[model samples]
Target: MKRFLYFLSLRTGTELIILTLLLNKISGFYGLLAILTGLHLSSLQLSMYVYSLFALALAGYLTPHLRRQSPIHVLGLAWFYVIDTVVNAVYTAAFAINWFLVIGQHHPTAVRFGHTILEPENVTSISIILMLWGLRIYFILVIMSYARSVLRQHVYSTSSSTGLYRRENPSDPDSGTSIENPFATNREDGKGWEGRLGRAMIALVRSYWLGVDEDDGWARGMGGKFRRSGEAPVTFGPMERERRRRSGTGPLPPPTSNPAGIPWATQGTK
Candidate 1:
């Protein structure tokens, strides 16, 4: 239950930040009122606002805890905010259409979804809001995508610059071999799997802090970090491979390296 609450709070905080930024772009109280009034169902809109406020508060309370989680987990939770925004927008549109139909107001003449457009007076406002929402979504997605790419590149670059993701434990040969992001190991040797994992993680952290995209994938200084990529199966460390093998399971294949030589392994090791 605590974990669930923490997750919810993190999600809420992200949403509040986005909302605050969005509100700042608008005029004043009148602008707020306009946006609020544009909603079709007053009660539902009020409920949404209240819920969002509560979520923001909860998020604030859990900020420190949320930060302890992996970046991937945090990014996934933040995405829920995007989903919520889209859902709320849909509901707002639905409510507006119903209200317009009921009041017999000057409905929009534009044909929409096999029917007449609703709420002509507010059509332009609605369109503008939706467009802005799309832009915001795009901006957030781009930032996250860039962050993910940077992290991946950092991992690759730090692991010997071979760009070939490799697993340790040559006994099984293919068993511990891969070409994806290597896992952190904890074996005895300084050259064991843990060392590689530690290096990759450190590089990811450094890249994240420096705002460097080794891949040059996105614009810098966006501060957003939820970028996604094609499903690239990651390489497991020797320990993980042993665990899997002991459990009678085979690991997933490694991701293909970029032709640009995104190094995945150390050069000297056989």
Candidate 2:
């Protein structure tokens, strides 16, 4: 995530994505207002809003999982964001071309004509277009980087839990754990066309999606920031707890000092 987001700012990829997600949520509200105000949106623009609403619902539902740190939900949300960004850009372009043609009767859209399309003029519109696309690319990278971090961290934590249970290696190396590619495996989770699409997405950015980051000084309790008293802190969250309970490896030993990490996960670690 640092690899993708650190160039833009010191904030983690998750932090950046949260801001972008807020932007999308705000834009969705504007869309709803347009519909309610009886604005004349083209069928295409209307269709875009329909897709926007769907993405809005998904973003609303799954965005909280960022705190929950559910691998499947987080990964699903990340992929949804990527798809929405690309699709929304296409819709925007279509609307722009239609509006430009319609306005051509009053203002010239271009000075020179090409094979089928006109050359874009160096104007406010061009600058805005460039800026929007640049931001979209940055958002895409930040999202993918965060998603990969979640996947890798889940694997690492699960490995740590396993070692704590079995007592096989006190200082167990992760050499035994094969990081599962969520898009490539799992008979239930990684089947069908969605999985294929995920694989294609990963194939396009394999190194970034699967690579390790030096800034992964990830510790326990990055999440569950606002848990109520007696509720399980979502540090490793439900996934880790369920695994530990099933394995009969209960709570982690209490910290000698109440350090940064949450020693209690469910009023107890397990």
Candidate 3:
């Protein structure tokens, strides 16, 4: 959906992880449907499992959207993802056991369950299921990777507007309580271990899993720009004001433009 995609664009690091999380949400919905149709369960048990999954999937979708817009929500979202991953893995294992060990051993041939037949021995069906499970496992890794990025951004931020996890409180009353540390050596300076590990994982995933080499060509040109200097207003304003104060002189009075477009200071002459 367009609205869903708008949230995804806000991610600064681990874009693949966000993408996979979205995809996983979609797959989870489908799995929920499959559970309803393909598997047999008691009315109470089925309803409980269905409701549980529905709630979890809803949380998964909402967390990313909330965290994307507000950095303060990232930590809570990370915990949600961690719990969701474990639950999903347990559900996967349960299904795998039912499909292969129990069903395959007993019903070598396809068994009719209502309108749809459960076929555990079908080569294509099994292969498809295995592939989906493998993708799910990889997505768990993606979720962890993104969580680390969120934490890294939360722990250190150079500017309120900059970074993945931007600080929410820009106008705190005690803003001067903490000393600022600016590291402009690299575009990703002060990313800490979480960031470095996330990047390495992303690179590895891109290379081996996605079959694409990371394009570091842009890094060479971008380095100088990031490392050059902070923006003029932020870097120079305080220093210039301090210099004026030290010299016992405030800002020059407004200049008045004459008819010929020449300007003169507004100071009165004795």
Model 1 error, position 165 (Å): 2.4
Write one digit per residue (lDDT tens) for candidate 3, span 54-73.
65565665565544633324
Scored by TM-score, the top model is: 2
Best by lDDT: 2
Error of 3 at 115 (Å): 28
lDDT, candidate 1, equals 0.46
User: Candidate 1, residues 1-270: lDDT per residue as tens digits?
Assistant: 112124543234444555554453233233336565674536665565555555455434433433353433333334444555666667667786676565444444533532444445556766887798776675455434433443354444334324344444456665534333423353222256545644444454343423322333332222123223443334446966887878879666667765656466743355
Candidate 1 weakest ten by summed lDDT:
218-227
lDDT of 3: 0.46
Error of 2 at 174 (Å): 20
Write down the TM-score for model 3.
0.38
Compose the digit string of candidate 2's lDDT tens values, residues 30-132. 8768877788877886776677667767787877788766666777777877777778778777877766665564555443323114435525675788798
lDDT of every predicted structure (CA atoms) = 0.46, 0.61, 0.46
